[model samples]
Target: SLLVTSGPPDSSLQIWQVVPEDSADVIKCVSAIATENCTGQPWAKIATISARAPWVLHGSRLNSVRITDVESRKNVYVAGSSSSQELSGLAFLDCDTLLLCCAEGQLCLADVRHPQILLEAAPIPS
Candidate 1:
């Protein structure tokens, strides 16, 4: 199994591999990648791993969502641009689709292949 984590203080994302040991399962960090254009900003408040692909999605306080390729140890795409709304959660609908939840009660569906296009968006009823 693999795990992805974000470091707000370091402004980086890390990928960890879990290895079975005799005594206990050992978790080791396999890769670490620095977040671009986010030197002073927090990296991620919410994150999600893709079930069908070697990808990880992270949402930061800057109202941006970034997708990282674990195998390449690099950012493959920035899913959405910055906005007034803050990200509250992130999930992978599929290998190419993502669900973004915002603090202002907006839910968005974005495609990984087309970062600029919003497949769908709606407000969460209060």
Candidate 2:
């Protein structure tokens, strides 16, 4: 198993590998990457690991989101929302599809293959 974590104050994301010990699980840092320096919030607020792909999607309290390749330990894509709302949630619908939610109740669907174009977006009802 793998675990994804973000460090506050310091802009960094780390991936850990879970190893099965005799009676407990031991985790070791497998890979890490530095995130973009957001002026206010330098740490990731939301993160999700893909089940169908070796990809990790994370976003800070800003409008930008990053996609990292676990196997290569490199950033594969970076996208930013046109809206100024802060990111609230992150998830993977499939290997290629991603779901993102904003603090202002907006939901966005994006395709990993084409990170620039948003597939769909709508406001969620209160």
Candidate 3:
């Protein structure tokens, strides 16, 4: 299974499943999460991650990442970002470790199991 997040001025998160069919790889969208509610409220940023089972992390426009459970459809963890930091990319380094890049030139290493930032790096100004 794979999770993807995308938007252009607005964002959405989706989960996909990779299957083998006819000796080829086929990707299918299994779940589409609403980044906005009925009132048109934004829920996530343009970056997302599929951590361990049931734990899906979504970036928000408000400089924070929200961790939600696919099974319960509830929030589990919320990782806060700086005011100048907006999530630009997300990658899983391991089962519990994640790498997050920000638009403001910050690289953050976070733990998926808990709401803690293990490491962070910011680009030096020229």
lDDT winner among the candidates? 2
Runs in model 1 lying further than 4 Å from the true structure: 36-52, 61-63, 80-84, 119-126
lDDT by residue for model 2 over 15-95, one digit each (tens)?
Answer: 799998999989998878777756467467545665656777887643568788877777777774565567777787777
Each model's lDDT = 0.70, 0.72, 0.60
Which model scores highest in TM-score? Answer: 2
User: What is candidate 3's lDDT per residue for 1-126, written digit by digit as tens?
Assistant: 565544443455666778889989999878665553223444454434444555666664324566667666677765655444555666666766667776666787777566655477767889
Give candidate 2's error at residue 99 in angstroms.
1.0
TM-score against native, each model: 0.75, 0.76, 0.57
**Candidates 1 and 2 compared by lDDT, better number:** 2
lDDT of 1 by residue, 51-110 (tens): 655777776642467787778766776865657466677788777887877766677888
Off by over 4 Å in 2: 20-24, 46-53, 80-84, 124-126
Which 10 successive residues of model 1 have the least lDDT summed? 37-46
Error at 84, model 2, angstroms:
4.1
Q: What total of clashing residue pairs does each candidate reach?
A: 0, 0, 1
